[model samples]
Target chain A: MLDHNAAAARIFTAALIVIGDEILSGRTHDKNIAQVATWLQVQGIRLKEVRVVADEEPAIVEAVNTLRARNDYLFTTGGIGPTHDDITVDAIAAALGVGVEVHPAARAILEDYYATRGGLTEARLRMARVPAGADLIPNRFTGAPGIRWGNIYIMAGVPSITAGMLEALTGTLEGGAPLLSETIGCWVGESEVADLLRQTEKTHEGCQIGSYPFWREGRTGANFVIRSVDPDRLAACCAALAAGLTAGGRTPVAGGL
Target chain B: MLDHNAAAARIFTAALIVIGDEILSGRTHDKNIAQVATWLQVQGIRLKEVRVVADEEPAIVEAVNTLRARNDYLFTTGGIGPTHDDITVDAIAAALGVGVEVHPAARAILEDYYATRGGLTEARLRMARVPAGADLIPNRFTGAPGIRWGNIYIMAGVPSITAGMLEALTGTLEGGAPLLSETIGCWVGESEVADLLRQTEKTHEGCQIGSYPFWREGRTGANFVIRSVDPDRLAACCAALAAGLTAGGRTPVAGGL
Candidate 1:
């Protein structure tokens, strides 16, 4: 079992398992990684790692057991629909050493939803099947609820539905202080400011600076993102970086280029 | 050691490690995952898994060692630049029990490329560092060349730069038959045709069918993606699916909606 109640000042981390073959085959561009990462940050939790796996039972089971064991929480998106490829619930159940069972509330919700559209079919009821002893995360968009078994959150592969599940999950999990960031963009090559960045990050004990270089308008530029759990330290690090860029005769853009 | 001389008819798989704090922070939506996935598909190499980790040494080292050991090929993008956060070279070296060294050829290439553009400062020279006993993957976008050691390919984080490196290394690696896919769109909910999809896929032998549901124009619809390595099997599966959709009183779109 994970020691979730370790210390108040400890960092809270979550890992995501993206279950789908479409993503691996390059048929779909995944928006859930960024969506979940951003949402976790706002909830004061850090998204430490993400694994994109194919829609296979062993693959999903391995990823679920591996990530859920290491992180504070595990969130999965995809493979929960009514199709044959939708096997996340079953895979996760096997990983947790549990049997698959239909959640009463979820079945009732699907029945009510399909009452007017069409009578509930066995295929539609597949959406209600969850790992034994699992709760439901309400979905406002579709009647199919997301599954919540232990720390594992099984969300929909669709971006909009995932967004609704995230909205419903806001402020529900315990987390540390939110990681704050300040981005400073400059129309200068990153190599020109690498030393300054290293120095600034070293000066701020709790801060980290990331340099992302890009070529735009036929000129080399980069956006340096400084992050820290402390707001005062984040601000100081950003100011130092801005000063360094100015000292090097480059005007820094506030947000990004 | 991984057996590179596997049976010719066997599937060749590769894993990708995307190392960056920007991606984990949700500040940057990753483009390299799709780019590499598409490129690897064209090369007839199936992408088995992808792990996105932060710009930390232990994280990079763990991902590198784990993925490199399991897959036929392991590729990494990001943290290969001149910034302080760029620690891919050192971390990979640590993982392989190798030492970091400045490759003379890489140094010469950087000297030539940076002669007119700022004359190769110390910070820019950092790009020349590589894991010892590693070959270079040519980069036409910038002076910094990608690294190739054993079956691991260390690529640039920038999508364009990574594309250039991938283009340079094209046709150099051996792989099996490329995976083929066909998409059929229908204006019907996936649950309505789930049984047909499951039966069709089971009957098709090697084909796997994925159903992606969407809502547009205030109407429910779905796109069924059928994939197989054998062209005949893929075509047969798509034809069967289209026929089934038509039999169920739905028009199937050939290339998806």
Candidate 2:
């Protein structure tokens, strides 16, 4: 009951569900959030929001359902390894009201991978399981494949494996133009240029300006990021914003202060 | 309407709302998530979930309301600066149905901070604004003090400032026993010993084992983390798990692989 034509013209967005108790426990510094967000940007899709949930089934299911329903695509990282704690596949199946079954192709791949080192034991075989009706997201870095079911893409918790899966998925998903941005850093307080930022963004069509303030070396500064889908408009907005900063008696740094 | 007696015995949990577009845009790598999570862990409070939202009021309001209502406490970082884009106070006020006002103590702190530098300009004075009925969480690093409205704590976006606020508020929040953990690293694939992990954890009550697999130096391995609120139980669980790994022909690394 959705209009495909209307969806095509609109911007594509994605939400990332980071599944791990280690992250919440502060034992593991998460590297997936940044990598996924950057990859989504390169694919011309906006990373709208991110939720880091625990390994619990209820938490995973709730996040998966909520994010998948709202965004054009939903990607999850972590909890897909071959161990007792790796239950992302099962959780996804439960969330989608489907049964989990071992995919033969994934089984064959794992079997071949472990044949030389060690035979695929029951524990290792867990990697072959996937939700019914899901397809394999080929992982070039590892033999255990990622999963792609509907709009949800289940990837590995490891940063390298997730990067490989993202590389395989490049240019496959339909997306709008990649968001173009320019940063204008100045040594002036952002509050002093609040009106200039507002007016510059308002004058530029389809552009948004974000002011990030920082205090470094006993001095205060801010980086103004101007973003737009169009490259030319982004440049124009950046130039105008930089000029405004100059007129306000601050020398704007090209990249950042 | 709420049962205060029932809440006193339960474990204290917190949810963090990171408010900034720079983070979602992949332009800024967030350091606040780890800092807050670690701080909460040290305080004996569990970080249950984290949601990163944009600077938009609707997103901030929704996240604040959803998290603050469900968890024992809600902490928000970013968007508490002096720029026009800093709208956390406004959004939080809207969510709590409170009015925004300049706290006299906060204003005095700002005046003292900037009196020798540039005096209290309107832009610098913006940092003193807070939601009505909220008390100040002292910040030794910066003049802009953090805000505390009931169970919600509003903090600065900068990591160092947030750290100062956290240091000042330490030992003030009521918390249960701090969670203790032990990491046992093995040179074998975690799937090969999944049953061992499950059995070990099942034998040890109040302990949960998490298997984090990794591929390094062209070899597959995993680090098994054992966690429990009781220190004695945590030690016992680690011993049993280590014995299991050793019997299975894998030398357990005491610290990590």
The fnat scores of all predictions, in order, read 0.82, 0.69
What candidate 1 gets wrong by more than 4 Å, as runs, is A1-8, B1-8
Model 1, residue B256: displacement in angstroms?
1.6
Q: Write the per-residue lDDT of candidate 2 for residues A1-257, one digit (tens) a residue.
A: 25754553479999999999999999999988899989888988999899999999999999999999999999999998877788899999999999999999999999898898678989878999999998999987779999999999999989999999999999999887788788889998776787788789889989999898888898878899988887888989999988888887889999886
Give the DockQ (2 decimals) of all models: 0.82, 0.71
Candidate 2: misplaced stretches above 4 Å? A1-9, B1-9
RMSD of each: 3.3, 3.3
Per-residue C-alpha lDDT of model 2 across residues B134-166, encoded as one tens digit per residue = 999998876789999999999998888999999
Q: State the lDDT of candidate 1 residue by residue for A132-158, as single tens digits.
A: 999999998889999999998999999
Local lDDT at A212 for model 1: 92
For model 1, chain A alone compared with the true chain A gives a TM-score of 0.96
Q: What is candidate 1's lDDT per residue for B1-257, written digit by digit as tens?
A: 23532443589999999999889889999999999999999988999999999888999899999999999999999989998999999999999999999999999999999999988888888899999999999998898999999999999999999999999999999888788888999999999999999999999999999999999999999999998888889999999999999999999999999
lDDT of 2 at B151: 98
